[model samples]
Target: MTEMSSAPTVLVGAGNMGGAMLAGWLDSDTDAGSYIIVDPSPSPTVQLLIDKHGLRHEKAAPSDVEAAIVVLAVKPQMMETALPALTGMIGDDTLCISIAAGTTVSTIQSFLGDIAVVRAMPNTPAMVGRGITGAWANAAVSPAQRDAADRMLSVTGPVEWVDEEPLIDAITAVSGSGPAYVFYLAECMAEAGRRAGLDEDIAMRLARATVSGAGELMRRSDDPAETLRKNVTSPGGTTAAALDVLMGGDAMQDLLTRAVAAAKKRAGELAG
Candidate 1:
């Protein structure tokens, strides 16, 4: 259990990712009373947590609040309106962490002045508390504030801090968008199974289960994924036969390399 912080933590959104973090914090040792959720329309899940924990929920941002951390979880599109309204929440000691994609630290600093800022990119898996966040903090952030932000984000998953802010786009290209690529693999595998005479339902189930099980194994084992693949492949086995086509001429590697490159390029464009 995390030691509870007496100072309030202002959460500016209550959507999927935001709601997941909120739920995680409430379930942990963090004081339930320390949260202040600011959302015009809170999701049922978020509202339920608020009611059950006796947390504060306001339709509009409060001007008189002095919070320890101000989490900017609203969508990038809504940030223009949200930042201006929530500027008062950024006191001298407050640490501002923005989870909104494509919003740079400079933009946030412009709106809220030179307060400590941590910009983070958290993926969809955060909804299940299995996400990994790539965070980058500006020079103004203190060590204590960095630790505080890390503890807060750990409720969702591990935190990977990078010194170069631009590397976040690469992280965005990889883990942030990586889940969809895995899902697409499952979809492709299911279709291939159907073409191979398996029932559509059975094929889909097999594909989904295989992908998830392999992911779990990778998580539990210290072995690298390449090593795991080698362990499964015999001198002349069916798995090797399949890998021959997949790995032949590095087809899979080349495709994914190009795909991630494109994603990173687009991320830079969006951020600009």
Candidate 2:
């Protein structure tokens, strides 16, 4: 196995999600020089890292370099064109991991041909290292190769392993698309506060803080979320009044079920 710092880990895009992953790796003290970013329009966040570490950022895939790992961070729409252009980088030893939402492991293997490949679905919360990634590797991957792949992804967050390939798509529907659902809740909370006559700015501030604080509490507390939730809800009080509207007639539960189902269907469609 190659030493973690020996060979370059090529990152294929450096936009918001890509940038976040890069920052997390660096923040975790991974060798900065170990990254080679292949991005045409790298955001300022990526540029900041380049400036600090004097890291390599190539407009196209380097023909002479051998990457220990090649991370496909580009958009799914662009993968068909981009991966073909990068055919030279794939080799027997390179372990490729893709963070693109809809692209499947087989689709990646179509371009990579025979190298080890892992399909990963990570949520936006990875920006803060509070995310969980669900990943599945093709059968060609060895045990040591999978360990290396897991270590590489650990730069972002925890890894959850799966047996079959299709589960990654379900993971994409859940954790991959999960953050936006939380953000929408915050939005609605702020809007409801405004409707109840609070100032718009204050309402927004409260909603953001509450949502973030609640997540932190859940992380630290031994109590399950349901327990904490019940602790706030009184039998004949304001919290109960709010829960009556949200939980009554299975409103929140049904809405979330439909929402997740739609996301899952869309993930499959994209993979197709």
List the candidates' TM-scores in order: 0.96, 0.93
Estimate every model's Cα lDDT from 0 to 1.
0.89, 0.85
Which of the numbered candidates is closest to the native, going by highest TM-score?
Answer: 1
Write the residue-wise lDDT of candidate 1 on 17-82 in tens digits: 899988888777556777899999999999999888888999989987878888999998899899
List, in order, the clash count of every candidate structure: 0, 0
- The runs of at least 3 residues in candidate 1 whose Cα sits more than 4 Å from the true structure, single-residue gaps closed, are 1-5
Cα deviation of 229 in candidate 2 (Å)?
A: 1.1
Model 2 over residues 1-272: C-alpha lDDT tens digits?
23543678889989877888888767765577888899887999899988888889999999978888888999899999889877887766888889898898788878878778888887887777778899999898888778977876777789998998888878887888888999999999999999999999999999999999998989899998899999989899999999999999999999998898899999999999
- Shift in Å, residue 117, candidate 2: 0.9
lDDT of 2 at 258: 88
Displacement of residue 138 (Cα, Å) in model 1 is 0.8
The TM-score obtained by model 2 is 0.93
